[model samples]
Target: GEREQVDFRTSHRRKDGTSYPVEVHLQYLQGENRRVFLAIVLDLTERVATERELQEAQRTLSTLLTNLPGMVYRCQNDQNWTMEFVSPSCQNLTGFSHEQFVETRQISYGETVMLQEDRQRVWQNVQEALKNRQPFQLSYRIRTAEGAVKWVWEQGCGIFSATGEVVRIEGYVVDITQQRALEDQLRKTERLAELGTLASGMAHEIGTPMNVILGRAELLMRKAPDERTRRGLETIVTQVERITKIMNQLLSFARKRPAERQGVNLEVVMLDVLDVLQERLGKQQIEVVKTVSPQLPKVWADPDHMNQVFLNLILNACQAMSDGGTLSLALHPIDDTVELIVQDSGSGIPEEQLSKIFDPFFSTKAVGEGTGLGLTVVHGILQEHQGAIRVTSVPGQGATFIVSLPIYSEEVRHEA
Candidate 1:
């Protein structure tokens, strides 16, 4: 019994007939005239159970991050905002792997990920929030890996030590690009409605004076006694007609066009617009590229309104390019909507003016070049058809306008 000592774990049965895991230490010693044995037992059930629970929790968190629609990140508050930890979904958000940002000194969050124009503002807001111990929330755009622009929302807070020193920050970044775009479209529609109301009142006020001018000009033309006077009167008549046409366009922009809800082919509408622009294109040496997918589903819109949408956009694209350039028209289906993408190789719009392009009476053209209502009319028509439009451009490179309309479904066809 004095030979050795052994230590191991086993399930032990208690006097109450309950068993649990245990670690056992047993030893035997030889005294002067007698042998002694000793044993020590330690319970391992609680410790093993705790470890299992911890592992389960870790697995659950991992599952959540994998399926999360957004990215969860933790990073330093340094100049580059060096990332510390990032979830796997970060790839979908930034097109970079988690390892790419974690402890990355080469390209931290701000310099490489955020848009250059928005960096300073983002820094300011985040710093202000950090100093005030409040969460920072910002909506900004990022340049995607594919060179497309994306709008993202970031909400984060500073991690502080016990001494009130901020050493790191953590946050969630979600791709709110689509949501932000829809908000912008809603705001523009609201503004268009407001402008329409104002235009209706103004049109009423302008119609009477316009009629007086037309009547007086006609009377003067009929009574012209000399060739010079006749030419002057005839010029007045032509100018009056031009003014009337301008007024009609304003009214068209102001009044809502009722949707006929027919199965409308936007590609055919685009072809018609191209047909009308054929002569102008020839004069300007402009080439047209049409990439409309054949047999696409029709949209629930009025054909006339659809034609107006395409015509205005096409004419605008044509006018923007003073010299010969490529004009591209592309059509495709996006989920439940049809998207018509029109692009031009003309001088693109300035960034500052992008937000105001759809505004009423806004134009970048020279005097007598445009009535400044073409785009407004286009926007109004799209709104009437429950459609949407968005534009992207880089100054001097060119512009692309995307128009999306609800696709007509079989249910609607049967109803019609």
Candidate 2:
């Protein structure tokens, strides 16, 4: 038998639109007597293309999971701490890497959870689930790579082998930092509000007796023969009056009053407030600069409540400027509302603590120096008047508070 020259070729295209070079193989079946020629065509293009696409998808998914704000992980069921898989997010959540903890066994995942006494409770739950072949659910804090810690909730079922033996544990973890912080703040605020209510009740009950004592002391001072006795009685009477004022402020903040609205001239109210605090301002050397418009229209508010508002604000301004600075009071018309501005050249409020100034029982002053209800009472009073107040300050420069009230006209009231 003699063989003849033969040539064959084929073409194939990959998934990525790449063409593969053609190749052919020739073979003969020796068992058959005649020349039985066989040809085989090899096309590896499709398989190669599929593998490349799979790799690209995996890379994209890995990048996404790694940059996620939560932790993703996979662990084996063994007590020896074998890791089937761990995401790069483990570094952000638990201060360990996927490779370091999985392949090299450089860290223990369970040990890094939390060091508190409650950690034992978590371990006990995990042990019971593993022994009973049940799903595992746990939440705990974990130390992270940058020395930061975060809360994570893990819930996952065990993967079983063909024989029903547990094989692996896989789950996701989320950063609950913001949720926990809100919860803490809510608890604190609730406590403070409760304390404010109790303090208000106590102040009301004690105020009557304190006033009686103060009146008695004043009467006794006038009649005391010895100068030292008279001086001591005067001091006691002054302290009792101060305490009574603080209690009134607390009660105002804690309880709401049915507003007795009437035509109120803001300029007249400001003048009265200045008169009440004139002696105190003089003692503190706080200069009052009033720029109230004489022709300003009236506002609808309770006269007494409005007077208290001005007193609280002006007194606070005078107290703030301990080094003797200007206390500016200005009233101007803005659209349908009148704006009252009280500014002081004192040490300004800190930015971080400004938002809490209206919160009950929150104060920057030392204990006994303040009841922390001054601003809260002011806020409540303004709220009753259907007005709004805002504050702007810069540390070391000063603070400005603005109060806006709707203008009241005789025509509007008569029409109503």
* lDDT winner: 1
**What C-alpha lDDT, on a 0 to 100 scale, does residue 97 get in candidate 1?**
76
lDDT of 2 by residue, 342-381 (tens): 9999998999888787776687666766667778778877
Question: Model 2's lDDT to the true fold?
Answer: 0.78
State the lDDT at 353 in candidate 2. Answer: 82
| Model 1 lDDT per residue over 76-104, tens place | 88757688888999778878777778744
Error of 1 at 405 (Å): 8.0
Winning candidate number (TM-score): 1
What do the candidate models score in CA lDDT, each in turn? 0.85, 0.78
